[model samples]
Target: MIRDGERVTLGDTAVTAHATPGHTMGSMSWSWRACQAMTCKAIVFAASLNPVSSDGYRYTAAASRPIVAGFRHSYRVMQSLPCDLLITAHADQDGATDRFRTAPGACRALAASSRTKLAARLRADGPAR
Candidate 1:
């Protein structure tokens, strides 16, 4: 298994792994630097941060405590990533397809968006146990 924070080498690129266990217990994110001629860009492939659950699953359930905590941690991890390009597991989740320019704050914005989604779900479904 690829452990969190481990760097895997691929050709001349080094992809660093990040554990972003929101969508699942073993969800992962990756970051790497890519260059073209002269300039290089920091790119991050963030994992799906959605607060999805199976039918009848409850975020407030005792067994879901770790999953809920994972969501929160995933948000923090996404926000802290330093990258010129941000790619999410779900293209629509972070607006990666419609972006025409690089936004330094994209990672932060993506994290905020995911956090908002979780908040909405928690409010609409169940606040707490």
Candidate 2:
């Protein structure tokens, strides 16, 4: 598995991993630079923001307070990135696919928006007491 902040190179491009353990403890987001002709853009493949749990998943348990905190931390990390393109684990999360074709820097906006939304969600749901 790739560790957080580790950089892996593929051809001339290098991808850096950012740990975003909300959906799962090992969830990660990757950031890299992509070049097309004369254009070079920073891209981030964002990890899922949705909180997921199976029948026995710890996240669903009353003791999973840390997991909820982790999600908040991940959202903060994502908001701090300097990415020109932001692609989420789910396409509909940020309208990334369509925005990628029409607008650059959409990812930045999406990141901020996601952070805001997540904060509100967490506030409403509250951390496990």
Candidate 3:
């Protein structure tokens, strides 16, 4: 598994992992600099922010508290980055394909929005019961 904030090299590309544990523990997001000839851009592969389930699922369990906190932290980290491209597991989550062509700050905006939504959900649910 890739450790959070660890940078790994793939051929000429350097990718940094960011642990984002809300949807699942050990979930990761990645950031890298993509270069093409003289043009270069910072890109981020955002992790899934939506919750999912397989069989039995519980978000209010005591075991999930820390995982939820990790997601919040990861959202903050993502908001702080100035990436030119943002790709998430779902295109609609950040409108990666739709907005990538029109906006440079879409990733940051999406991060902030996701964080806000996550905060509200946590507040309303009050953690695992």
Determine which window of 10 residues in candidate 3 has minimal summed lDDT: 94-103
Q: For candidate 3, write residues 6-116 as lDDT tens digits.
A: 999999899999887777777888889988999998888878776544545455568767866877777787777768887777756643554242267756676677777
Q: Using lDDT as the measure, name the better of candidate 2 and candidate 3.
A: 3
Between prediction 1 and prediction 3, the one with superior TM-score is: 1
Say which candidate scores most in TM-score. 1
Candidate 2 — which pairs collide?
none
Model 3 residue 59 CA deviation in Å: 4.8
Flag regions of model 1 displaced more than 4 Å. 94-101
TM-score of 2: 0.73
- Which residue pairs show backbone clashes in model 3? 60-128
- Residue-by-residue lDDT tens digits, candidate 1, 13-37: 9999999997888999899999999
State the local distance difference test value for candidate 2.
0.71
Instruction: Return the TM-score for each candidate structure.
Output: 0.89, 0.73, 0.76
Q: Give one digit per residue, the lDDT tens place, for model 2 in 1-129.
A: 779999999989999999987767788899898999999888888777765455444443477766777777787777687777767777566544442422555555665666666556556554444
Give the per-residue Cα lDDT of candidate 2 at 70: 78
Error of 1 at 39 (Å): 0.8
Stretches of candidate 3 off by over 4 Å are 51-62, 94-102, 126-129
What are the lDDT scores of the predictions, listed in order?
0.82, 0.71, 0.72
